[model samples]
Target: MPAPPRNILASTDLHDVRWLRSSYSTGANNCVETARPRSGPETGLLAVRDSKNPAGPALLFSAGSWAGFLTAL
Candidate 1:
């Protein structure tokens, strides 16, 4: 009923997530990483973070928004 959680102050806060990289990405790690939190406040939402900074803040998006973003791309 309430809005989903927003930016995570530190990626480390998501202890249960498994960040995934795109297969199309190069080994340089320049792409953004995405994860779906299986537990905690972020569960069922998408978590995105820059590969260049693993410990940096992560932004969260709802499933509908994520799908729309991919469709828009």
Candidate 2:
């Protein structure tokens, strides 16, 4: 068996992250996805999870923080 993915949040209330599909996803193979809250003033707190793991869990990051992460990649 493979190793489990590392949990990103130890005590985050994931109820607030609103998931959204990438308009560019092909929906046939592995594709990248993203999500954010529907309404909020929270800073640097965007939620992200794997598309294949809807029932699993998610990682939380600030909007700016997440942006910086992506930028680094």
Candidate 3:
């Protein structure tokens, strides 16, 4: 299959996705939030968005790409 798009126009475009923030996040919504699309074209892809802008666009990454990003940190 072809690769998924690099991003979605808006996080709202993803349905039924449960956004999650790191446990290390403070009360301030400064950290990024992540979610996995359980259905639709984005299924199996990781979605990330700014916590402060839930309605903003989201960056989509494959599982391996997401893992490598975290491993490098």
lDDT of the candidates, in the order given: 0.93, 0.57, 0.94
User: What are the per-residue Cα lDDT tens digits for candidate 1 across 7-66?
Assistant: 898988998789999999999989999999999879989999999999999999999999
Off by over 4 Å in 3: none
The best candidate by lDDT is 3
Global fold similarity of model 2 (TM-score)? 0.58
Candidate that would win on TM-score = 3
Model 1 residue 33 lDDT score: 98
Cα lDDT, model 1, residue 69:
99
lDDT: worst 10-residue window of model 1? 1-10
Candidate 3 structure quality by residue, lDDT tens digits, 6-72: 8998999999999999999998999999999999889989999999999999999999999999999
Model 1: residues >4 Å from true position, as ranges? none
At residue 42, give the lDDT of candidate 1: 90
Model 3 Cα displacement at 50 (Å)? 0.2
Order of candidates by lDDT, top first?
3, 1, 2
Better of 1 and 3 by lDDT: 3
